[model samples]
Target: MVAKSAKLTQLIQAVDGQKVHQIRCGDHRFIDVTIVQTQGRFFVRQYKFSKRSWYDAFINNPTIDGLPNGAMKIGDLEVQINGKVPEDLQSMTPSVNQAYRKLLGLVYPLMRLTFDRQKHEATTLELIPVFDH
Candidate 1:
């Protein structure tokens, strides 16, 4: 659900470094990701899913860059994901899985049956707060 009172910046701050956020875009299903504060800016890591990556789904559309207005949540609290797999993805998966184990455990098992790690790409989604319409 889209938050009516919470600004994107506030929401980012609320979850940054402390918790994981699940974000859903357009008609896509929700995925648990994090809001990382890096190099004095914020970014969301999007992993490539089996068939398509977040970058693949939204890159062609210019509307996503602006991310206008509100952000989405699942049942009150959650976040977003993005991008293609990185070159070092194999190395990264172990830690990524551990950090998000509580969340991933529920979905990873079923996903492992059909999900091939090599099929996806890792990319970053820079979160720029769009305050006004």
Candidate 2:
């Protein structure tokens, strides 16, 4: 719906027809992204610009090349996790309760994005996408 990044707009247009599509995270889950076509459709992963770890070992190590895979396949859409709270809520500290709630709110779109990975077009969050919708 809303195009925040010109790169993303170009990606969607890059493979404007056919069926299956995918994008690669070259730098990390945040920095580099390249769109690829499978049969025809488009796919996008979650990435952020700030998450790139400029460390040597994680970057130079051959085994640790080209971003961690956080793009979960649901159907058509990929749930690109730019960041996530690795620990379960039950195990969270009491002081982080506010943070936990905020996280849930942030991840709600991601949860819906799950359906997109599955190629389910009926994806909707409480019957809404944008707040102004």
Candidate 3:
């Protein structure tokens, strides 16, 4: 299940304007990530497939101590994963690409390189506020 509308709003507001945040997985692991919001949905992309301990940890043990599979933290805000959102590799919107490039501050060739890397190697996951019970 996705977050309740109000909680989702709050979560989006909390993270608004922030490009990078720490994502906590398992009980004591945290990794710095760049978060992007497009169409009012939050996404985190793994730039390098080689460095995927965090992703591995989340997938292998998404939750601990009775938490949901999606339970995780972004910065100080608690959130849940909505699994991996499908990326339309062939049709990435300009705005979305721009958002990522801005967050990364990459120049022409580097931007192209990173974008290609993302297309070929990275995983994009949608994040939602933890559902309220």
Q: Largest lDDT belongs to which candidate?
A: 3
Residue-level lDDT of model 2, residues 1-133, one tens digit each, is 5454543444334434322333222334332322222222222223222354322212233222323433322235443322222233233222232322233456546655554433322110010011111
Residue-level lDDT tens digits of model 1 in 21-100? 65554566766666444333344555544457545555443354644322445346443323323345556545545444
The better-scoring model by lDDT among 1 and 2 is 1
Instruction: Give the Cα-based TM-score of candidate 3 against the true structure.
Output: 0.63
For model 2, the local distance difference test gives 0.30
In model 3, residue pairs whose N, Cα or C atoms come closer than 3 Å (at least 3 residues apart or on different chains), thus clashing, are: none
- All candidates: TM-score: 0.45, 0.19, 0.63
Residues 1-133, candidate 3, lDDT per residue (tens digit)? 5447877777666656566666655455557776666667666666656655556555566444444445445556776554344455335445456667766675534846545754633455555444752
Runs in model 3 lying further than 4 Å from the true structure? 1-3, 59-67, 70-75, 87-95, 102-115, 118-122
Q: How many clashes show up per model? A: 11, 17, 0
Whole-model lDDT per candidate = 0.48, 0.30, 0.58
RMSD of each: 7.4, 15.8, 4.7
